[model samples]
Target: MKKILRLTRHALLREQDAELRRIFGSDLEIIQVSETVPDVARVLAIIEEHRPDVVEVILPHSLTAALTRAGLVIPIIRAITRRVLHEDGTKDAPFSHYERIISLEIVSERL
Candidate 1:
């Protein structure tokens, strides 16, 4: 059987979902959640409910800090953005192109 992955983002975009699906392919089940700002409890609840192989969280730094302070055991991938800025400081690429995944464990270790 294929593995299941859970992805949670601040604003769930259809294009992001499609990109993820394309990357993972049909062999993996990708469960997505969209919330403006998901608290640690809500994130934990989702993990408990889904029991996914890995949980990818695309949230702001503040919330990610809270999650780290909460000390969650489940593996988490922090989805970062690498955007190209225009002369006016506007983003030049789509959201998909800016996504960069990093493990929470690695993030914590650096601290």
Candidate 2:
């Protein structure tokens, strides 16, 4: 099983987390850390404890670039979203990340 650490707490992320957990079943393991603190040490400790294969860093205020450049052996995924307004003025295309991330979430939910 692939281990994944999720770093996000936004409404969308939380929704995705729940949905993912519902979809993945058992192929993956998800560990989530808080977004309140940007402390690298604390985050690193959580990552160390989980020992995840990937750390999904979602919308980190100022630490995204730094963490990405830290050169950690574990793969770090940065989640980005695009807010698009429809012709009728409705928001669309809310949460946007790599398809793999979506797949991972779906897989985890199933498990």
Top model by TM-score, which number? 2
By summed lDDT, the worst window of 10 consecutive residues in model 1 runs over 97-106
Q: What residue pairs clash in candidate 1, if any at all?
A: none
Q: Pick the candidate with the highest lDDT.
A: 2
> lDDT tens string, model 1, 5-109?
444545545665566556556566666666554477776776778787656776666566666667555555644455788898777644643243332332544
Q: Estimate each model's TM-score.
A: 0.54, 0.61
- Tens-digit per-residue lDDT, 2-78, candidate 2: 77788777443655555554544447787776556546676777677888887877644445555654567877765
TM-score, cand. 2: 0.61
lDDT value for candidate 2? 0.62
Off by over 4 Å in 1: 1-26, 86-90, 94-111
Alpha carbon RMSD to native, model 1: 5.6
